[model samples]
Target: MGNKPSFGETDLPCPQPRQFPMLLWLLLLLILPPGRDQSGVTPKAFLLLNPPWSTNFHKDEVTLTCRDSLSPAQGDIYWYYNENLLNKKSEEIQIHKTGYYKCKTQRSSLSDPVHVDFSFDKLILQAPHSVFEGDEVVLRCQAREEAKEKRFYRNEIQIQSNFTLQSVSMNNDKYHCTALVRGFWTWNKEISKHLMIQVQELFSPPMLIASPSSPTEGSPVTLKCETWLPPQRSHIQLQFCFFREDKALGKCWSSSPELKLPTVWSEDAESYWCQAESVTPPIRKRSLRSQLYVQRIPVSDVTLEIQPPEGQLTEGENLLLICSVAKGTGTVTFSWHREGTVRSLGRKTQRSLSAVLQILTVKESDAGRYYCAADNIHGPILSKLIRVTLRIPVSRPVFTLTSPRMQAMVGDVVELHCESQRGSPPILYRFYHENVTLGSSSVPSGRAVFKFSLTADHSGNYSCEADNSLGVQRSDRVILSVTVPVSHPLFTFSPAVPQAVAGDVLELRCEAQRGSPPILYWFYYKNVTLGSREAPFGGGASFNLTLMAEHSGNFSCGADNGLGIQHSEMVILSIIGPPSNKTTLITEGVTAGLLSILGLAVTAALVCHFRTQRNSERLSTTGTPSYSPREFKEPSRTSNTNPQEPLDPVEPQPVYNNVNPGDSDLVYSEIWSTQHTNENSANSPRKHWEDKEPTVIYSDLKKAYPDDSTEQASIVDSDLEDAVENYENVPCVLSALDR
Candidate 1:
């Protein structure tokens, strides 16, 4: 054994088997350091780990240290593993791999090596190569062996522990792992594994929708179903289904999501929805519900009909019309129209109905085209036109006379009649004169007649009016004339003596007090008329003619005016001869003169007597005479010729006187002769005695003395003279004597 066999530098398996020899060798080696103390002086360095040992994988770490004395002199230090340099460091070295490691300081003189075993060290995984946003990448730090706990480290920072394997999200970074053994230093190692994670964006389903906003009822509608998707998905085929009330409509598949129907009716009203589908994994069913409203369109079948049909209507008749609907519903309003004017008849709102319009007592004004209309709340609908006609009956009318022929005279009668043919019933007839209503009689079947007596007052226009309900119609005007009867006539002669003289014109006029037009007058003078004339609308008629001896006769006049003839009172015309110019002589011997004288005296006396009688009668009848004579004077001289004898009362006297005288000489001639002769003698010779004394006469011996008879004559004469004197002086003179 002395020999441990010199084990220096020997490669023997049992070299250390014998300790004595090994110790002797190490002692020798130690003693022998004369060669350069190659065994590094006990290194003044300490090994340092960044993180403490833990069981977690991400918390493990290891550090190799080679601290040299002298404040780590500036010299390259070589880190060695098993006496081989693995890395060089000035101060320390880090180890990321899970393995046993030792650090040595190599200089001109070698340093003691610091040995570390990282058997429980963790290996850390680095960040991935590439990673996208929102991606999960695993970063693992695994320990070489299970440790009580593992800790991970990044750039000397400690991580969570308590795990055999630690993981972290990747962020493109290099990573390392470290682990700790219960009774040893921490061990850690970096891994070369890198991860590259790529992140992708998620896709969402497309949105589908319908269009057309809001739709109305009964209107044509279009539905649109559309979706918005990424442009990259445009090529994908898509199908859409439009549905209403959970029912599919028509063909559901279409390139576009819109459905179009030309028109919609009330029956098509419902809630609507749509769906869009694609070949993609998840089908898109996007829908919206919309309400569809249906509206009713009013029908237009309104008619108007008149109840009685339009025809001629009389006054006080009723008018009726009806408004009906053939096809309509809802509130129906009925209105009647006349002449384009509307009238409210009646209305029914609950249901469709009819309306009746009645107009009582129809008149002429009610005739017109009548129509009705039916209306719902929607609009007014007109009906067919109906014509209405009204008829008016004739009414009872009055009649009047329109002519001026009402009043008529005797022998003249006027006819007046009135007609009212339009009246309902036949009318009776009556006549009126000066407002006097006449007896009523049947009007016959035609014209009525009335007769009026002709009279002066009848000279007026007559009028007649026809009576009917329609109206009173007057006839043409008429005039009437009445003829009057002639009145009694009177006639008288101008010269009232005996008759009218010859060559005298006798006028005869005939007249009547009253008559009508066209009066004819005829005049007669001495039974003959000079001319006949007519007096129209009469006054009087006259005739003038030259009277002749033959014309003396009874004359009369005739008057006629168509009514009757009238005659005037007759008048007689007379003609007489004038007296002769011979004179008569009256004497006591009955001479012509004497007889004439005596006759004149007697005639004068008789005429006086008769005249006195006539005067007395006139005075008695008329009460008094018009004239009377005053007292008369007697003869002054005593008459010598036995005074003129009184004239015989019976004999008539001549109107003329004659005288004869003879010349005498103192012959005692009668004093009357003497006075006469003296008077004649006193006158001139050219003046005749006849002119001087026309009635004076001298009897032959005029102075014969009177005997006693003369005395008696004287006495008689005296008495006669006294009587004449008394008679002449009397105050009571005869009326004839006065005249």
Candidate 2:
């Protein structure tokens, strides 16, 4: 409150001409917030001091100020220090002691207290934020002016005779300054707080490390900056950047310790480094160069090549095999193997990525699948299996004869099984009889069977030959005896080539030639069993049929020995009666109608026969015959391969028949007779027509018999022969022809 020129003063000193007090004051007034007191005048309360806010043991002058926006003063002010009240009208107060001071008014709230540090404390040391190696570092100490001496210490080491702020060409250290006062038996010294100067190794060489240490092409890698500063400067904020030798990479400045790379290509295998920089002082350090060598892709597309590379491996021959890479990168190990082996036949580890395997002599065991493998750290790849085969001449073959009986006989199926013991697969076996090649068969395992019906011609020397790629070997000859069955029985009547009268001595002879000794003969009259006779020696037998109406039927005989039976041709014998008055029984009307129907039926049958023969010839010439059923009402047949399942028999492809009413429509009476007449009938047109494709029509016979009648009936439906089966009808046919 007193005007003692205190440090906290209210009045301002006169401004120099360069300051222009009036303009400066007006500018200050314009900038301050408008504050009006209760007296209707703009007023503000503030404090200013001379020699700043503190005094060093009262060595400097003190002043204070309380300025207002409108005028220096318009209201009464109050001042307080250390809670000591001064004048209520005074606006400023100052004291040279470490204490709180403030100003207040009735309209204005109390201002914040300002504490001035005026303790007897004395030492001060200054250091810069950024310091470099060998740079001048300044350490200052300030204490009471009356102190006899001042000293400085770095890291607790004393430095004598330094009174003013100290300077040295050193960095990165801690220093403390102090003043010693000689007080005649008392000691008082001012010590400064420790001041540390951070020295940056901004020029220290940095090192880089590739994270994962070893990298491969096409895989990602991380480059890290491995560097450090002095322990004292470890806490300083820094940033890092990466570069590919000279080119900057992504985000040159990164707060992260390391930079992540997406991928590395072959071209990325080059030198790289990093730079570390201090943020505050802007110091940068370059890192040591590092090389990144990326490994390329592994081996691919491997193959094995044969040395000779023609035909196949042969027995007793040396073989050379090579396993090589078609395309790949980097080192690889090559290996070879047989099909059924786990261990490699040959293996080599080389940068060339190829290997060779050799066999001194190829044997049957080596005639198998072989392959090669290309292996590396990446994975193993295999080539396709190569098939090697060895060929050797076939050895002498052994012949086997398979027959149902010890002596091959007619009607017996004989099989000659042929095989070679040692030979490559698919050896052909050919059967020969008396130097004549019967047939040839190929067997993969050098085995086959030739089956044929035994005949007298087959009863001779039999042999077989086995052959392969190399050569053929024949088996020695072996005799084969075939027993012939009885030939067709020769049946004859006593009166040869003549009709028999009712009283003629009729004798029938049945004989067989070329049959084994001892044969039994059976005589049939119109398929009726008459009698059987046996000859102790292979010869003829006889049967007697009295010349009567009952004996006037077909006569045939069969001879049977151990071999199968053979039947003779039927013999016809008709009795001619003298013209006389004899009563005959026949339906006039029925007979005429039946005869007309028979004629029509015969004509249709003949027309169908002719058409079928032409169609069959055309079909045979074309080699294509189509077959389709006439009805779809039946259930569809499913296809099956099982032998037990009955096969669907093919239907005859119908051909339209054309016949003139009077030409080529004749049906001879003898053709319908039960008796077999002329020898040329064996090759007769009737028989030939029966063998051709038939005309399938909607006939009543089909409906009458149905498919359920006989076993496995063909599409044509077997003819019943009902008329000729009744031998009595033969007389009627013969009589009609005679008429």
Candidate 3:
């Protein structure tokens, strides 16, 4: 009766052969009993408790109620602690110790075991690893397990549940777990620490910091990302990324805290930031936004431009000096200055890329070398030195013809000097004579001197002009008269028929073509000086004289200016009378063309006579005899006419009154006539003058002498001559008869 059960068998009989060992049976019993009943129907067995997990603090007793689906009402409950049986036949049991516990109902197999933690320091509220925007966060409070009358509170809200299940964290809500005990309420309640569920702003705007603050173009720049997370979760591993205006930059998905640019160009100018994200929790954070800019370099090809691109600068005109930078940005300042001047001619301040320094009214003093400078607060750039010269227009020029004397002589070298009072240097001068250019000369000293040989053609109006780059200016006209020596004089006579009768008038003229004005002309007969004449301006002179029987002699004329006197060729004149034979006297020196001046009335009468002679070649000598009037005595002689005669000035006549042609062969003769003698010498009465003489005066006088070689030529005989001689008693008449 005292036999113990062996390891593999017992005294009792069994149908199965080779039963399992005790340890094996125990494992089989634990694996197969909870899912089935002895009647071969499936039964469900589970534990009912006040909470889900264990706590560390002294907690309320947990009523572990085991239930089976096979049982309708109350059933026997079996309890175990650390795999050892504790009680049976109770529907529920209360436990206070922290250990492995399990239970079974009378109609079910043993249930799974649960572990309890009685350490109060470890009883805490736990939350999800990350809480992001627009996401649900689950929070759990762990305290006493499988206890009745458990209460869950969150931010002072009570949920009607025996145990805290889970919390969905939408904001930063506080959570805790508590329970009531079957014992007294003084000390058996289990409570958990409050848990704060934080709904974090997972990603904030990122802030960026640049190295070398302002970077120039084509230079390197380093940007840093400044982002952080909550202080408590700072240990979380994160990855860094960079962005610019919401676009990813180079190596955007990196873990580095900074981004480096090898060179910053113009295209890199934009707003940039960085982001930091947790590796596991997928939480991302960004820094505040920052702007990045790349600086522009200075222009290299700076230039200076002038307006009016051509011509020189003049006073009272607007001048523009443009100082410009072809490539650059921002404010640029321009300045203009002369080379020798300390002050700048102009200055301009502007924000544009180019600036112009303008001089509204330029002055003559502004002439000098010029240059320009530009600056944009970096450094000054100077343009190449440019020279500007102010041009002054030439003034009225003063012309001087340097004649040794006041008179300009032919074949003399004359100096012409032209100058302007106010003008720029390098002036050109030109001389003009009668509107024809004589010469041109250039001089830098504002005056030009030219030399020219004077001639008769140069004796006219003289003027000069001065010219520079500005304009041309002319001087007043000057009259230039060149003195010339007189040429040979010429003598001529008018009324060129035959020899004139006694008391006939003769016209004589003297002329010279090349000489100065106011020439004096003189008439001469057989080496005796007659009268003289002077031309008022420039030309020749003429004279009138009466002829007598002694007028037959050599004649010439002379002309003189300031030079010596010049004489003309000599000529001979003859005195003629009417004769018995057919005689004719021919005049000479009519073919010589001598231009001479006469009085206005005399010239008009001569023109009328010429016209009449041209119309009628000859006049009728049968009409009543006409005699020409006597001319006033002015001592005059021509190349063929003499002044030593006592003849009236010769005028063109058709015929003499009461005179008939005796057809004389003699060119010269004397007249003798009979007259009444008185006893007393003073008591003679004159004969009638209109009565026709025995013959023409010339014929009667010539016929009074005895004919030596003639008979038909003689109209009167020697006895007639003796009768006339006995009647006249005058010495002068005897003298005429003696000739």
Number of the top-ranking candidate, with lDDT as the measure: 2
lDDT of 2: 0.63
Best by TM-score: 3
lDDT of 1 by residue, 1-739 (tens): 0011121211212222323333343343343332222223232222334442311243246555554333354556645454445746656666665432333333223332222333332343333322222223444555345443445554555656432212222233333545443335554333323222221111122222323444333345778764443222335567777777778877966767678765554556677777666654223445556676545456477777775655555567788787788765445667777866555444444344677778888777777787777776578888877788654443332344433434445555555766654443345544454444544445425667776555566654554544433344444444554545666544444444456656566565567666665777777765566578788766876667676666656777777765577777786666543223322222334565556555545544554454456557668998985322211222233333534754222211111111223353212111122111223344732255346543343323222123544433453444323322222211122211221
User: Can you write out model 2's per-residue Cα lDDT over 1-739, one digit (the tens) per residue?
Assistant: 0111121211223343433433434354444555655434343344556544232344444555554433355577767665555664665555666555556544434443444545455555544434444334455566554564678886798865442322222233567777775455765787776765533233345578897666775578999886554423445677888889689899868887589997775567789988877675455567767888877777788888876684286677788878888665556688888888888787877656577888887877788888888976678899987788788667899998888977677778988888888887779999999999999998788478988887666778999999887777989888887777889989998768558766567788999977876889999988888899998777999988666656676889999987688999998888765333331333466678788867855554544454445448659898885332322122334565778855544422222222223333232222221222123656543465456532233211122223553432443353333211211112222223222
How does candidate 3 fare on TM-score? Answer: 0.32
Ranking by lDDT: 2, 3, 1
Q: Would you list the C-alpha lDDT of every candidate in the order shown?
A: 0.48, 0.63, 0.61
Q: Write the per-residue lDDT of candidate 3 for residues 51-81, one digit (tens) a residue.
A: 5334434665666666665544254566777
**Residue 631 miss distance in model 3 (angstroms):** 54
Higher-scoring candidate on TM-score, 2 or 3: 3
lDDT of 2 at 590: 68
